[model samples]
Every structure is written in C-alpha cells, then in structure tokens.
Target: IEERAADASTPRAGPIPPSQRSDMVGSAEGVTEMAFDASVLRERDFRDTRRRIQLLARLPDIVAGSVDDEELLVRVSDTLLRATPSASAVAIVRANVPEPMGAGDEKPSNEHPSKMKVLHYDCRENGAQQHSVSSRLVTTALQRRESVLHLWETERNGGIEFTAAENVDWAFCVPLRSEACAGWAIYVAGSRALGSNWKELADDSATLADRLGDDVKFAEVVGSLISGIRQTSHFQQRHLAMRRFFAPVVLDALSGQDPQSWLQPRQCDLSVMFCDLRGFSRTSEMQSDQLLLLLEQVSAALGVMTRHILDTGGVIGDFHGDAAMGFWGWPIELQLSDPHSDLSASAHVVASVLAAARAAAGIRMDYAMGQTEFRCGIGIASGSAVAGRIGTVDQVKVTAFGPVVNLASRLEGLTKHFGVEVLMDHASASALQAWLGQDEFTEEPSPFRLRKLGRVRVAGMKIPVDVYQLVVPSGGTQDLTDSQIDAYEQGWDEFAKGDWDSAYQRLLELPAWDRPKDVLLRLILQHHRIAPSGWEGVLDFPK
Candidate 1:
C-alpha cells in the first residue's frame, strides 16, 4: 500500500493527456451573448437578490386579502421576516394615521374618542443580531424620502443594544407615501448568509444597496398597498359617518370628485321640496317626560324622508328641527335631455313631485303604526334657485336660496289648512302634467292625483300661486274620488271666473270629507256671499 501511494503522489512530467488540456471555450451553435448592466446596476443572480425577488413576488398575494390595518401590518411584517433570509427582524410603522371622518369632533360635553395607532413587528427568536429595530434609521429614511442601509452596531443607534452576529446584521429603512395619512414607512433588517465580512460590506455599502434595491422597492410597493387599503377604509368610514348629515346620493356624487366644483354657489333651475312633521308640537308637549323616545321617533320619521329623497337622487339640503329640505337641478349630477338645456329644470320637478308624494305616503302608511305619531306635510316648488353652502367657515350647511325655496315652505304650511299631506306650486303641478302626458315617462298608472285648489297668497309673498293638492291615491291622508275631484274642479273654475255665489253653493254641496273646499267656503262667507271688488279669487292667508 505504501509503495502504490508513493507512485500515485509523483507529479506528471507534462500535460499531454486530452482530459488535462488547459484550453476551454463555449460552442457558438446554441448560445447568445448577454452583457452585464454595470452602468446601471451590477446584474447578478446571487443568493440575496433571488431570495428578495421571490419574497417580493409572493408578497402581494400574501397581503392581498388583508383588509384590516392591523391584520395587513401583521401579514406584511411576518412574511418579510419569515420569507427573506437576510431579514433578522422586520418592523412596519404606519405613522400619523388619519382621523376617521367626524372623528368625534363633537361638543365639549360629549364623550370624544381617540383613534388607535398602527404598529406591527416580527422577529426571529434565535437571539442573534436582528431582535429590535432602530428609530434613528426610520427617521432618517423618512427625512431623506428614500431607503437607507445601515450597520446594526453603530453610534447612530444609541441607547438600543445590538449584538453583531455572524449571519445577518444590517438595517434597511424605506419611506412611503400614503393617501389620507400623515406618514408611512417600513423598516427591514437582518442579513442572509453568503459570508459575513462587516468591514468589506461597510466599504462596499453602495453595491450592497444596489443589491438591496429590489427589496427596497418591494417594501415601497407593500407600503403603497397598505396606504391604498387605509385610504379606501378612510373613505368608507367617512361615508358612513356623514350619512347622518348627507344623503347617499350626495355622498356618492361627492366621492372621488372635487367638492369645490360641485358645492360652489351656482344658479340653476331648482325643484325644492320641504317636509315637516305635522303634530310635533303637540306630541312633544305630551311626551315631554319621555323626550328620548320622542326624539327617536322623530329621527325615524326623518329617516323615511331622507330615504325617499336619496332614492330619487336628490340632495338633502338642510334639516330644520322636524323639517328636512331636499332639492335637485344643481347641474352636478343632473342628466339633461338636451345638452344646452337647463340642468334638471322641468323634468326634475316631476321627479321631485314624485319623491315628495312618496315621502308623505310613506310616513302615513309606514310610520302611523308606531307609538309616535308621524304625519308629515310636504311642499314642492320648482323654479330658479341658487344652491350651495350657506354658512361661515366655522359652521357651514348646504341649502338653497331664491323665492322658490320660501314658496315650498309656505306650501308645506298650506297642507295643514287644505287637509292634505302634500302640495305643489303651479310650476311643479304643470310640469307633473306635462311629464305625465309624455308616453315614455310613466309605464304604470301614477299614484299621484292632482286637483287644483285655485290661486292663493300665503303670508310673506305678494304674488298668489296656483295651489294644487298632490293627492296620493293610497296615502294615510284623504283619498279623493273621481266625482269629488270633478266637483272641486267645477267650483274652482267658477271661482276663478269670478262667480262667487254659484261657486260657493256647489262647493258647499260636496261632502264635508272634502275639507279642501272648506277654505273656499269660508272665504265666500267672509265677503258676505258677494264677490268683493278687485278680488280675483286669491285667498290671502293673514299672518
């Protein structure tokens, strides 16, 4: 055995064997030339690059289903710590989390709430290099608006102790931008094993940074996803909070759209509807001991009105105690028949009429069974009105201006006098008729039945408006028959034509259930069965 080993250990005199030849070359048949991208970055598929890429590719899929903020942070931090060989520990801090809408900006006496901050961390319990993250690194990255690479054992990481390990001991910080947030950033640190040469790695920090570029970009992309999810959640939270103040249509129109362009004061043909609870004063007096219960009932009734208004795509303009005002035709979301036509003008009034009638009928049919009495009087008027925010900077509210708004409120008052739940001005009544005349407008028999109450001048306005009862065929209020409608119209025409005695007699012949005619009967008797000179049948209400 010793003699054979001595012979085998002897050096060869020359490299004459084919297997021992030094010449080595690639075959050109099936190969293509590819150059290194050193000018931009050193292109190499080494361990760290490939591992980070794999982690990045799998990242979005991992965090894609995470909807909650804390849950998302957990998924991202945990995935980075576990998947990336270089990461000793990972920390993602969502800085300056935005306040949810309304964010409890309530009165001082009210109980205010605070929003929770989102912070998540993941660490390997190997008790080695990457146990805790450095705060200096995070601040520096945010200040520079870029990712930063630092050695773990540095004077910059003061007060926090770190033990440099043989495997992975480096820190990375990547700053991120998020919509609707104060600030967002991610901190990933640790080393993957190739060889741990701390001095050489520090000297070649630039190249190391280039190698970590994909990981930096991955952190940013995840940060962006977190930001987007947070923003969407922010919007949803605001949408729900503002539902107390705004209708869904209003919120939908304003969402992702410029509020300055939509809410700026503008002149438009507006159809305004005003609704008020009828027996609120009486009910409040009777239920004063149980005010909370009465308040809940009022809220429920307003909810019905708001639902109807929003269902018709109307803007809920304002709420005055037991009253709510809704309007359309601001040109924001109006779909006009003609491109040059006034936004929603005449046609929109017909829709407003429908919504107002529906709201009144809904109150009587749906709310009458509740313990709280809910009888609403709704008035609809259509004309030019300037619509927009009508308040100071400290306090603002959406409302409309112009004579039409006042007229609608007055018509609402007239519902009590006329024994009707809904009423509309001449403009709205005419538009309803015109819309009903069009074959395409209504496919079913309209629940709305209109009967003229002749011209009447309410307090605070000189011009007498042609009043019409918006009779719902199945409302909680009186449902007039065809004969009753004919009788009312016959007397109204006679009254409009200046035949007071004959008109008064026919109106008296109608049943007392036709309470709308009672006002006419009293007016004729006010003038002693004779038409007063210059009295053109305008029943002026004394204030």
Candidate 2:
C-alpha cells in the first residue's frame, strides 16, 4: 500500500469523508484492504527534534562560561555523552597539531606533531579509551577534512592493534578545523548495550543523522571557539613577557599585528637610566676561587634592579657585564587616558627616574668581597632619543640611542667620583625639581634629597652639564642633614664666586667624613687656595 493510505498528512482543503477515513475491515471477492496509522512514528520524530533543540540551546551558555580550554572540552564532552544515549563513547581530538610557536629550533619528535593529542575521551561505565579504533576515526576525519562513518563489523583489525572497542558496533566522526596544524575532530561510537542495531528503540527505521541530531553543528561551533581561544592565548603569553620592556601603546600596536608600521625608527623624548654594581667586579676578581658564588650574588642584585625598573614601567636594554640599563618613554608616548593623564608623560619620566635611583640605593648586597657591601651607582638623564630596533642588518634590538643615553652612562660613572649612589644630568635634575614642586610631592617628606652639585665638564664631551646628587640615607650611611646641606651650599656659592678663602673656611666647618665636603676641599687644595686666571668654576673631570 502507498504511504498516502497510512499518512493522514495529505494536504487537502476539507476533511475526508467517513467512508474514506474508515478502515476496510473484511475481504470481498478475494480483495482485501487495510488502513494504516503513523501517529507513533510522528510522535517519535517530534520528541527527537525537541531533544536536539534543547541540547543546542545549552551550548552557547557552555562556551561562554568555560574559563579555559580544558574546562571547555570537558563540559562539551559531558553534553555530547548526554545527547547520545546509544553512544558507548565520545571523544575530542587534536590531530597532527603543529608544535607551538618558537619550537622550531628543537629536535622534533618521531611523528612531527602527527596523529593526535586526545583532548577528551568518555566511554560507558568502567570505560577506557579505545585508542586503536578511535585513532583511525580521528585520522580519517582530519585527513579527509569531512565526516567519517564506519561499521565496526565490516572494518575489523585482525592484527595486534584492536580494530574496535568491545561492544562498540558503529562510529561516526566530524572534522573541526581542517587547516589548523593538521586538524581537529570529534567522534561518537555506538555500544552493544543497545543491541547491534539502533532500531531497538528506533522502531527499525532510525538513521545515523536521525540518531545524532545537531551533533555535527554542535561540534563545529565548539571547534571554532577552540581555535579562537588558542590564538588569543598564544598572543597573551607572548606579549606578557614583552610587557617587561615595551610601553602600553607599543604593546597594543604589537597585539594589533602590524609591527612594520609602529616599530620603525622613532625619535622622541625619553628618560634613560644606567646602573652599575659598585664592588661586584672587584669582589669577583679577588674571590676567583669562589667565582660561581660571586656571580650568583651579582645576578641577584641585577634582578632586583630589573624588577624595580619593570614595575615602574620602563624598558630594559644593554647588559654591560657588572651593570644593566633600563629606560622609559619608548615608541613615542601616546597620551594614556588613565586617571593620571593630567600628570603627563613627563610625570612618567620623573617617576621612572626616581624609581631607578631608589633601585640603585637599595642594592646593598654583601658578596664575600672584603667587608664592602655590593652597592650600585645609578645615572639618570631625560632628553630626546631614537627608540626602536637599533642594530646592523642581521642583529637588532629594541633600544634607545642618542646623547641622552651617553649622558646617563657618564652620570652613573660620576656616582663614585661624587661619593654618592645616584646622580642626574642637568635636564633630569630640572625635571625632578619640576615634579617635586607639584602638590603631590609637597605633601610628604621626599625620600630622596635633591641638591645641585655645580657644573662639570664630563670626559669625552665638549659641553658642560650641571650635576646633581640624589641622596637617600639607608643602612646608617652618612648623609648630609639639612643644616650641613645649607652650610655646604653657602660654601659652594663663595667657591663659585672665586672667593676660595671664604669657601675653604666654610667647607672646613663641616664634618671631615662628609665626602662631598672632602671632594670640594681637595679641589681647592689642588688650585692652591686661589681661583686660577679666567676660572669659570666648571671642574673638568680627568679622563
């Protein structure tokens, strides 16, 4: 009989006549007729469609709520298991995934990221991964870049490798990303618990698509989400390390993925800081037998300096044996719309310089080199510099270059000459004073005492620079009190005015142990307590 006889689903304008709707009950003249009903089949299909709709509805929430890849996979795997009651197992696999970024230099594995990394595999009660058959299904799906359906009975593995899991009679696999590495896929397998056929509950009419409704689309959606997450995670990890050097805007540009535009040569105002260990090199030389121990101590000190600079949002640069350098204001300062925007980029520069000085003062490690503490000398200079990838064609680095960089280095060297831990060039000193005049700085007793230490002709430079000392008394170090500082300045004014006798008398009144006083006193004694002819008061540093 045609299904139209059984199907009450024929579209018609009016209800059928009573004779047409009624079943033919008896045989007449060797002719028999029977009317069929399909309400049971329709009801089954309706329930299946509703179940799939419900499962698909829950997936968006699942993807959104998942915090990590593992969590995402585990939750989605649970959903898959619940969706297919006849399924003995479901699995998510990353097939032939390429090695991670920056792994090119390593000796590769035998398969070279081939086959798979099984993300999730769930079977029935007391279940284990059916690797033998599952591997085949994953490979087939990924390699073909499409779905694979296999009947376990027809495709048997007679060799050592088991062709199928126990009681898993049939399986289907769907491809995720075909071009990602090799690819990714998901698979579902039927169990003998439901007998050899799906028809036990399917009324002998169920098809695979009918059995696994919405699964293909669901898996595809999940695959796309995973790909996005993977890409994002890679960038985050890469840039998190880079943040220790690059500015926020530079990092943003990098994340936007066009380095060619912004990373080119940039000339802009920058604050450069140079720090060198005071006694570390001498200690290392003296304790040659314990060189390893000395090296560790020096490294720890550098680490401390590096941490402070990074915390203050500066970029680390050259490593000159016993020293390290870091700077601020790179790749041009885009005005950050932060709450401190009114403070301006100069504020950032000033803050970074102070932090560098504080870092230098705080480093008083005791390596086994005599009884001297491993102190550091820091120099800070603020001016214009070119900030970018600077080097020859083959080798390059993200660094700042210019006279400001040299001045920072020179000031660092002058720290020993001045008998102070930190020194700054004229421009840096002016910036510090400018920032200190602000309301924020006046509220607290400044941690560092800033003083103008007169102009000096630095070696290898024709132009003279006004030197300044930044003093932070720690560890019972002898620092000039306000009274002594006032007294020294009075003497310095006289000395600058060519009244050596007056300067000499005033300087002697201060403590003998006052190193700044001693340095000035020596300068006077060298000039025979008299200003030389045409003396301009700019003491030239002997090379």
**Alpha-carbon deviation at 460 in model 2, angstroms:** 2.2
lDDT of 2: 0.64
List lDDT for all candidates, in order: 0.66, 0.64
lDDT of 1 by residue, 77-104 (tens): 8876665446667777644322322435
TM-score of 2: 0.57
Which regions of candidate 2 deviate over 4 angstroms?
A: 1-230, 243-262, 331-345, 365-373, 440-444, 475-477
Give the top-scoring candidate (lDDT): 1
Candidate 2: tens digits of C-alpha lDDT, residues 12-107: 111222343233222222112221122222233433567777877877787668887778778777777777676777777776734422434322
Worst 10 residues of 2 by lDDT: 3-12
Instruction: Give the per-residue Cα lDDT of candidate 2 at 45.
Output: 41
